[model samples]
Target: MRIYGPSGTTIGSPAGNTKRSGSTGFSLPDDAASTQATRPAAAPKAAANIDALLALQGIEEDPVERRKRSVQRGKGALDVLDDLKLGLLAGNFDASTVGRLREAAANLKASSGDPGLDAVLSEIELRVEVELAKAGQF
Candidate 1:
């Protein structure tokens, strides 16, 4: 069946239409038609795959919450590093204390947009790594 408009012209005539395949009677090309036809079967599988990926990544926090958490982690890492520095200066730090500092450096990753803070963080990580090596725990 063909549809005619008000002027009695077939609506889907293939003249000057690149979207239509002439051999397919002004319809979608064969490959495109097959793709459109198979969409329903693929949709559910695609959705399931996306859900699985999100699950693996964990629930995504909003930007504000993410930034806040990052800031908190950076703060905690800085605090621990401060104590380690003081302990070093005082000449009374144990292997486990250095281990905690190493763990902090390994896990924390945040830049407070301050170059000094980033430099201090790098120093802390390096200092902890050296201490761990000296203790034969690295």
Candidate 2:
């Protein structure tokens, strides 16, 4: 994965099977040297400009607010899923209804993207749907 400079020297991660040499790597190519010489030295000025942009926008880091937002999103998803499960269980269950319920449960599991939770929810929903169908609830 490591890319190398033109001089056969490692510049980035070692190419397939190579390892990093602490802090420094092999030499640069002659072309690389010429390129470096011609390159404008504007890194410090760019960094100052970035800092000014941040200050002008009055941006500040807030880890607590970020965590709160994440928690709220998680709770909202959970609430929607809970409501779906409850509705599925309470609905009449004919063969066609059961099939639809199974499809919905599978879709829910797929969209949630968590295999463990998907499995548990799928089991609970499928068992209830099957029982209701057998009892002629539909």
Candidate 3:
């Protein structure tokens, strides 16, 4: 393979084209040229951008953490279901308990990034829905 460079070019003063061609030149917009630009300082803008990036990084959940959270939520939902069952058997269940079960069902809808866990949660949600439906709350 032949590596070709500019013809007749030397290390010093290569091509030596100092003039700007019309095709390569740039012009500002007429409105921009007429205004005194009031741009914010670079430091604050850079700081703001860095802060925003950090905030976004913080918002992203780790897969392991998300899975753990989903497990905890599932356990909580199961606990609530148990409480509801106990309440019903004891004839003390009320609207608030049903509301909590509904909320748990809603929370279960979020993905845990694990197919197995998701399947389990879906089953739990279905059970919750069935219970709610039986109670005429659905």
**All candidates: TM-score:** 0.41, 0.26, 0.56
What are the per-residue Cα lDDT tens digits for candidate 2 across 45-137? 445577688665534535455444444444444454455466668883335544554454344332233455446555655664554455464
Query: In what order do the candidates fall by lDDT, top score first?
Result: 3, 1, 2
| Segments of candidate 3 deviating more than 4 angstroms | 1-59
Q: Which candidate has the highest lDDT of all?
A: 3
Q: Please give the clash total of every predicted structure, in order.
A: 0, 1, 0
Judged by lDDT against the true structure, how good is candidate 1? 0.61
**Please, what's the RMSD in Å of model 1?**
13.4
- Return whichever of 2 and 3 wins on TM-score: 3
Is 2 or 3 the stronger prediction by lDDT?
Answer: 3
Which one wins by lDDT: 1 or 2?
1
True-vs-predicted CA distance for residue 38, candidate 2, Å: 56
- Cα RMSDs of all predictions? 13.4, 20.5, 14.7
- Local distance difference test values of all predictions, in order: 0.61, 0.50, 0.79
lDDT of 1 by residue, 9-79 (tens): 66567534336444766543445555665434444334557768866654564656655655666677667
Model 3: per-residue lDDT, tens digit, 8-88? 435554333233457856444355455877787676434557878866874797989889989999998999899989988
